[model samples]
Target: MTYTGDVQVGGPADVRELPALTICKLAVGPYDNNAYLLSCSETEESLLIDAAADSDRLLALMAERPAGAIVTTHQHGDHWQALEQVVKVTGAQVLAHPLDAPALPVPVDRTVEHGDTITFGAITLEVIHLRGHTPGSIALLYDGGPAGSHLFTGDSLFPGGVGNTWKDPERFTQLYTDVVERVFDRLPDETWVYPGHGKDTTLGVERPALPQWKTRGW
Candidate 1:
């Protein structure tokens, strides 16, 4: 998850190297959402995570690289603000959890649940269902081999705490429990976390604050 420089709206940060992939993080749209391009180094095919916003910008970032699909991390409006345009222009298939499919602007080409894995070239992304951030909120995990795993968390988990729960205590509880048991506890500390917005963080750093969030009732 270590990176340098900032990706202004319509631009991409320096590429990050992983075991079999190259990751480019772009800050796009009015919301400053983070759109990720995870490319398989061997095949050059990439998966766009959370088309968030700015079709022109996102498109420019992709350039001539072939994109396999546009995967919606959750149902939140901001996360998919530019989804329709991205899909239309790139001709990439759309995938999402059934619970959040109805919230998308276009029909989902594929519906995925926990334990399902999507493959593009030599890389495979395993889905992890995380509720509360959105009813069908999900994360993608790429086994990084010796480098640990890569986690794409869509507004479910973040650097300092879990995503905003809209003041719903029940939602907060659900998200917290899922994150703790499904994420921090199950994954190794070296896991890299890429969120829907802002900077990325590692699970090792975020693991210790679980108690604080629970105690604060956020």
Candidate 2:
């Protein structure tokens, strides 16, 4: 089946294949958080993004490869409900931004900041810190060159608008600025966005709406 980036809790994962990595996106937990299991095509080593929930299912998906690390995108409780169990089973190193590390269920093995690179097998993902959603909310960027780039945006961004700032103007501005400068301004429009919840979208599809999102002050 073609990759649609559509997934639901208890439903099958949506897989996207690139030159160096294979991304499997699954939704888990009561909050319907998306967990991405990324496997390197060359070494078969994997890295999981957000062990949100359903330890059994997440483990089953990692059966074929060695899970190297689990990255918690932020400090949100909903995003790490299954984290402890998953870490116990896989022994995957826990990675998160230093600002949010203390809040995660498991202690972070390494605290990452913007411009940092995480490597497992031959795949490397650059970290992009997107503040405001949480002080340390982050997005991982994988540049596939001609195939375009893939951004794993956890709560900092979504299809139609940026993450909810609870109507706080300062918070909204902070998130919007980082998203526009660190993300939209830096990456190409062809970048595929894999958000922490719901379906995916591309920068090209969302660029025109940036102004609208800012105007609404969300």
Candidate 3:
């Protein structure tokens, strides 16, 4: 089935997809940015992604299980509007790529790099440091986890094309190379991609568009 932005996974009714690796999605703030709460059913441990906006809403989502860490995908202001508030309440370790850490609202408690792995209960998420969208944009890939293979791409790879590089050909090239080598080429086609905003897509569908993306230069 195709992934749509309306296909939400937050509450009980829509929890049928994967209960083991529970993913709660929230679209908040003016830009309607996507924020995710990834929780491990076994340990009740969770990780927060983006913390984009609407601090109250994000805090409510973390009521049951406190997040051990809040990972910032990049340094963009839109993606981190509510970060400071969330951290103040949850006391989650702020994680970001060293290069992007300076742009964040607060100091990055933990610096994540390419190939680094983060543990949230039983699952270990691999960090992919992607360039182009932002120098230190990152995506999280879960291999053989409870929900099988899944990808959390924070403004990197999306349904139609890669994230905007502001027409910077050089940055686009770097992002393209990183996506092909680190993601599509390495991961299985079944890997589900949950983007930072809007809909999600499978690697199998996006894999065929790599050439077009390069040629067209988005």
Off by more than 4 A, model 3: 1-19
Best by lDDT: 2
RMSD (Å) per prediction: 1.6, 0.7, 2.7
In Å, residue 131's CA in model 1 sits off its true spot by: 0.4
Ranking by lDDT: 2, 1, 3
Clash count, candidate 2: 0
User: What are the per-residue Cα lDDT tens digits for candidate 3 across 190-212?
Assistant: 88888888777899988888899
Give the poorly placed runs of model 2, Cα more than 4 Å off.
Answer: none
**Each candidate's lDDT (Cα)?**
0.88, 0.93, 0.85
Clashing pairs in 3: none
Question: TM-score: which candidate is best?
Answer: 2
lDDT of 1: 0.88
| Pairs that clash in candidate 2 | none
TM-score of each: 0.95, 0.98, 0.92
